[model samples]
Target: MARVERDPTGDVCPAFEQPEFQAVRDSMKPNPPGEPRSEEEVLRMLRDSWKAGHDKRVEDWNMQVQRDREERERLEREQEQQDEEQAERPEGEGQKIEEDNGKKTKKVYFDENIAVGDTITDRPASYTLNKLKLIEYIELFYFTPDGCRKAQKESRSTASTETWGITQMEGEVVGLQPISALKLSKFVKPDTELSWEEVMLGRHAMIQEMMKLGDEVWPVKVVEAFNTMYAALDAHPMRRQEHGSEATVKYQAHVRREWYDRQARKQGFNIGVINETLLRSMRDEIIDKKKTESLREVSVQGFQKNLYSFRLPNPYPSILSE
Candidate 1:
C-alpha cells in the first residue's frame, strides 16, 4: 500500500508535518504558554515564529558549536601535555599518570557524546540492569493511586475527564488521554473511571490483561502504555503554561538534576551517591524506551526529504528532446 504524505499547505506548519524536522523546527516556533493553536493558526504562528527568532537561534547554535569545539581541543592539548610529562616520572608514578590520563580522555569523550545526543553504551552489565530497574520502578509507581497526584496537582478530577481536552479560540490542541490500563484494555473491558480511590492500578491490570493477549504483543502494549502516560503528563495545563515545551526534555541539565533529586527521594537513595555518570546511563535507558514507542509510526517526511535530495530522471525523454 502506498502511503500518502500529508500536505503541509493545508493548515499545520510544514515543518511539523515532517517528523524528521520537528526537533529543529520546535525551537523555531513560538509557543505561548497554555495557548492552544488550531491547524489554521499553526501556519500563521510558524511564519511569525520564524520571522521573529530563526536567525538569532541559528547564530546562537553556531556560537555554541564553536565553543564546544574549542573546549574539546583544549582537553586534547592538556592530555598531550600530561602524556609528555609521564615519561620523566618513575615507573610506578608513570603508570598512575597513564591511568589518570586515561580517565581524563574518557571524560572528554563521554561529555562530547552527551553534548551531541549520542547514546552511551560503555557501562557494566550490573549498571545497565540497575538502570532498567530504576526505569521500571518509576513506571510502576505511575499506575499506583499515588500517580493520580499528577492529575490532582493540575486540578483535574474524575468528575470530568473530558475537560482535560484543552481548547482555545484557535481550536483543540491535544485530546484527552483515556484512563484505560495501558490505553489498550478498553476494548476488553470499559475504561477505568478516573478516581484516586477507585482507579485501577495499571501495573496489576496490565499484568492481568497481558495474560489474555499472550507474549506477542506485550512489548508493544508496554511501550504504548508509557507513551500514552507521558503524552498526558506533557499535555497537562501546568506543564504547558508554566514550564513550556522544554519542561521535561530528557537532555536538559536542569531536568536531569530535578529527576535525580526526585528519584533519590522516592527510592531512598542519597543524592550524593547517585552521580552524573549513573544518571546519564539511566537517561539512555529512557531514551531507548522512547525509541521503542516511536517505531510503530513511519515518517513520511523522511521519504519526502529523500525525494528532494536529487531530481528524478525524466520519464518522457522524447518530449524533452523536442
Candidate 2:
C-alpha cells in the first residue's frame, strides 16, 4: 500500500492549537470589564508597570555612562603617556638654546617686583617734588582757600603778623576792597602761619591755582565772548550785505558742511549726503513722526497659526468689532 500523504494546510499541528498558546493570545487582548477593578488592584498594576519601565530606562542609562567613563579613561591615559614621554626628553634636544660664550644666558625677565628706579637712571628728585607741589596747589585751591573764605569772622587771632600780612596780601592781590579785607581778616587765624618752605612754595601754588581757575572758567568766557561777537557781527552794517553776497554765503555754507562732514567721519559714519540722510532719519525718529505697528499685533500675527489653542480678543471691543 502506498504511504498516506497529509495535506499541510488542512492538518493543524497539536502544539500550535495548544491551550497554553490560546491562553497567551487571550491574555494579550484588552481586558473586558464585568465590574471596575478595586482601587488597590488598579494602583498595584500601575505601580508594577511604572517599576518595569523605570528599570529598563535605568539599565540603558547605566550602559551609556559606562561607555562614556571608559572612553574618558582611555583618553586620560593617552594624555598622561604623552606627557611622560615629553618630560623624559632632554630640554636641549627639545628646545633650541642660544649659546653666548659657550654658555647659556637666559633672557632677562621683568615683573612688578622689578623696581622702576632700577630701570630708570638719573631720575630727577625735583620732578617728584614739582608733581607733589602741583597736587598741593590744587588741594589748597579747592579745599583750604575755600574753607578759609567760608570761615570768615570765625578764624582770627592776634599773635601771628605773618598770617595777617599774607591774608592782607591775598585780598590785595585779588583786588578786594579794604572793608572786604577787614571782613576777610576776621577769617584768618593769626597763629596759623605757614613755614618759610610753605611761603616759598606759595608762589608756585598761586600760579597753579590761577591756571586751574583759568581752565575751569575759560569755556564760559569763550561762550560769552562768542555770543557778544555774534551780536556785534549781526549789528554791523557790513554783515547783511556780506551774508547776501554769493561768495560770502558760499564760504560760510562750505565751512559748516565741512565741519559736519568732519564730525561724521570721526564718528565712523558715511560722510556727505549719506550723513545728512542718516541725520534726517534720526531727527524724524526723535520728533515721533515715524509710525510702526504695535508690537503685540505683530507678535500675534507672526504666531497666529502656530499657536495650539490660544485666541486674542479685541482690547477695545466696540472699535475692533465696528
Off by over 4 Å in 1: 1-48, 96-322
lDDT (C-alpha, whole model) for all candidates: 0.43, 0.39
Scanning candidate 2 in windows of ten residues, the lowest lDDT window is 134-143
Local accuracy of candidate 2 as per-residue lDDT tens digits, 1-322 = 2222332333322342355555544443445665555444544555566567666555666666677799999999999997797688888643533343467668988798756564322211222223233221112211234333443323233224323212222324532322322333323322113322232233233343334445543234432432333233234343244222222222223333454355446532221222334333333443342234456567777787568567787689888777
Q: Kindly list the per-residue Cα lDDT of model 1 for residues 53-155, writing each as its tens digit.
A: 6555555566666777999999999999987887677779977866897884534334544454464222112211222333322232233434434433333
How big is the positional error of residue 167 in model 1, measured in Å on the Cα after superposition?
Answer: 56
lDDT of 1 at 35: 58
Clash number for each model: 0, 0
Off by over 4 Å in 2: 1-35, 92-322
TM-score of each: 0.19, 0.19
Clashing residue pairs in candidate 1 (N, C-alpha, C atoms within 3 angstroms): none
